[model samples]
Target: MVFTIKKVINNNILCVTDAGGNEMIVTGRGIGFGHKAGQPVNSDAVQKIYHMASMPVQQKLMDLLEQIPYDHFLLTDELVSEIRKKIPYTLNEGLLITLADHISFAIKRKEQGVEFKNPLLESIREYYPEEYRMGKACVQRIQEKLSVDLSKDEAGFIALHIVNAELNTTMSITNDITRFVDGCVKVVESYYGRTFDHESLAFSRLAVHLRFFAQRLFQHEQESDDSMQDQDFRRLIASSCKEHYECAKKIAAYVAETWNQELTEEELLFLTIHLKRINLSSEQTTK
Candidate 1:
């Protein structure tokens, strides 16, 4: 496919249009160094092609390319590639713009010795372990490539960015989900009168469950009525594990009061089941 250069963004980046007039941003080493509008692009030199369907996102990326050093974009591109490999979801293309902007600002803040703490760091680490691990890798890569060492807090922030991209949601929504999950964990701990070991597999499973639960709450997704088919099992769990079942009730109450979202019977049933497993896991660990 022949690509006509629409604009030269930098020595390595160019805004180009294909034969069908679909605009895209392409990046490569010196791809745009001597290129001009209306010229044919050197396809062999194109290393990355950002075919963002959103015009606003495309424009934002182009503006960012003009503002920040091309190297930052390159670093973020590599990080996004790694993220894709680690995650099961297809990330929004806008991740390139958002993450590149974040890394550029983070580097500048590091240079000025200004560090911001991520309040949701712990929650993010618990809720999005895979993304958090990738975020830590990103921090290490930044240090190796740009000589700027960032804190674990930055890793959390980066993880939230990945979450935002994966869910196609805003950072505020991601923060809300993380905070909600943290609140639910605390509710469970308070009801049990003890903290579950954070590193335990039970806790990991619970965290994963709560993360998606919070997402559903935020999105207002409800379990279908067919979920009631497991009523017999739900009743069995509720009766067999009364204390854990009560703890699950407390969490459900907390969810209702905090988020104003009512949990369905299925949600309550699942929560009770998870709480039962967690309680049993804790019991075995103590014995």
Candidate 2:
């Protein structure tokens, strides 16, 4: 489809409108170098087209394009491509703006020798391993392409941004979920009097479950416990795994007290099963 250039954002980026008059931002090397409004965009020069449905988001991206270096936006675009290939999630288009803004600021901070420590770094690494690995790759790419080396803390920060985009939530909510999961894990550890090995499959499973559990809690969602079979299973778990069931109760209590959200029998049942698995794994590791 032929795109009419609405405005030139930079030498590499242009704001264009299609035949239907839907606005989109297109980017490529020198795509807008000599382009002007009312001209047809060189389709061959368009490397990536960002269609932001929200006008505010589109305007924010345009503002970022004008404020930050185009090269940073290009780097973030490349990273977003990599994330799409690696993760099986439909990320929000807002990632382009959030991540590009972050990278630009990170580079400037590096230049000024100013570094911010990510308080959630460890929890982020443990909770979102895939996204954290992608974040590390992003850091390495930045160093290779821009000659600026960023700390692993920045990788954690970037992972949170990825999580934010994936959940279509704010960064604050994503961080809260991470923190909530970490707190639940600690509660389990405290009750068991030992720490579960982070690399253990059981720990991974528990972490994944808790992450979603926290998300549901934050979103005020609850699982249905109306099924008689589900009730039977919950009873079976409570009987078969008494210790783990008690721990799950503790976690449920903590969630109720902290988040003011009550867990349904389904959540409690799943938590009991995960706790049982973690206990078994811990025993095997010790033996």
Candidate 3:
């Protein structure tokens, strides 16, 4: 199938429309060196073709590729491919462009010796271990392949980006969730007058619960009729575990002040149960 060139981005990349009218970014050595718009692209010379579903994403990739060195794009693609192999979930195709954009900027920052610490690294490491580990490995690969050294904290940023792409969420929302989880931990520690072991299974469970809790809160989902039975059971637990319920209320207050959103009764009940579980485990360890 013949692809008509729509834009000659550079010597290495060409924006083309395939025979089916699908916009694609075709990359090859000297592919666009002597090309012009409306000219037929040399099919034999094409090395990579990115068939994007969204025009905005395609444009974003094109714009990014135009700005950064082609080597950055190549390294970003390799990193994305490695991450996809290690992760269990499927990543969004848009990650191709976003990751490249982030890596290119990071590379420039590294060259200039700028410090870009991810404040949420501790939370990410504790809560999202797999993504965190994958991120570290990715950065190591980046250092080896591109000779750009990034801090371990930068791995946290990359992990969040991966999670954001996987969840089809924005980086802002993912960071907010990280902050929310951190706040929950602070509330628990302050309320109990002690810190729980981050590596504890109970702590991991709490972190997972809080992640989903934050997601539900952000989505502003109302209680469904099917949850009435579960709600009743949780209310029973809340009544029995008054101390835990009080701690849960403090967490809700933190959520309110930080996120400006009130938690539902269902959320409070679930938070109480998770808090109780963590508290009990901590107490047992200290005994």
Candidate 4:
């Protein structure tokens, strides 16, 4: 399909408006050379087309591209492709804008020797080991290709952005979820006087549960008590696994007070059961 050029970004990149009137960023070698607005670009010559999820993100990316070298854009595109292969979930298109813009700024800072440290790097590595590893690999790639060295802290930021893309959530919400899980895990560890295996299947399940649990809290969604009226069943489990139930109660209170959202009985029940398994497994191993 042919695209009408809206603006020429450079010799290799151009802002083109598709037939449907939506503005898109397209790039190819010499595609914009001698091109002007209202000019038509042959689809065959276009190598990459970035359809940003929102205009604000698109504008930010465009503004960044105007200041940074074209290599940054190409590097960001390659990184996104590599990250997609490493991740299990579908990444949102917004990653193109968000990640590209971030890399551009990071490169600029690196060139100027501006040091910015990420305080949550350890938390990210602990909670999202896979993504953090991917992020580290990305740093290596950037160093090799662009001759820019990004710190491990930047890797943490990249991993969180990857998480945001995978979850289709904003960076703020992703950070909130990461902190929420970290806090809850700390509570469990402190209560049992032991650390849970982050790689174990039980711990993975618990992390997944917390991911969704935090999502609900962020969205202000709650389970109705009317549907979970089986107080006797909950009480039976709580009575039998009193210690685990109490631990879960403490966690529930933590989430409630921290997020200002009450945890439903069903949530408390499932959390207690999961913690019971974790606690039992740890005890068995210790004995």
Question: How many clashing pairs per prediction, in order?
Answer: 0, 0, 0, 0
Tens digit of per-residue lDDT, candidate 1, span 39-136: 99867889988887889998999999998988888998899998988889888888988999999999899999999998888788777888899999
For model 2, what is the error of residue 120's alpha carbon versus the real structure, in angstroms, after optimal superposition?
0.9
lDDT of 1 at 202: 86
- Candidate 3 segments whose C-alpha is farther than 4 A from its true place: 222-225, 229-232, 280-287
> How does each model score on lDDT?
0.87, 0.89, 0.84, 0.85
TM-score of each: 0.92, 0.93, 0.88, 0.89
Among all candidates shown, the one with the greatest lDDT? 2
**Candidate 4 C-alpha lDDT tens digits along 1-287:** 99999989889888889889999888888999998999898999999888777798788777767777788889888999988887778888788678877888988888898968997888888778889998899899999998888999989889988989987888999989999998999989998887887777677778878877887778677565565578898889889999989999999889878877788878888899899887766667679
lDDT of 3 by residue, 190-252 (tens): 998987899888889999888867766776753643564585787688789999999989988
lDDT of 2 at 74: 85
Global lDDT of model 3: 0.84
Selected candidate, larger lDDT, 1 vs 4: 1
Quick one: ranking by TM-score, best first? Answer: 2, 1, 4, 3
Ordered from best to worst lDDT, the candidate numbers read 2, 1, 4, 3
> Which candidate gets the maximum TM-score versus the true structure?
2
Clashing pairs in 1: none
Q: After superposition, how far is residue 184 of candidate 1 from its true place, in Å?
A: 0.6
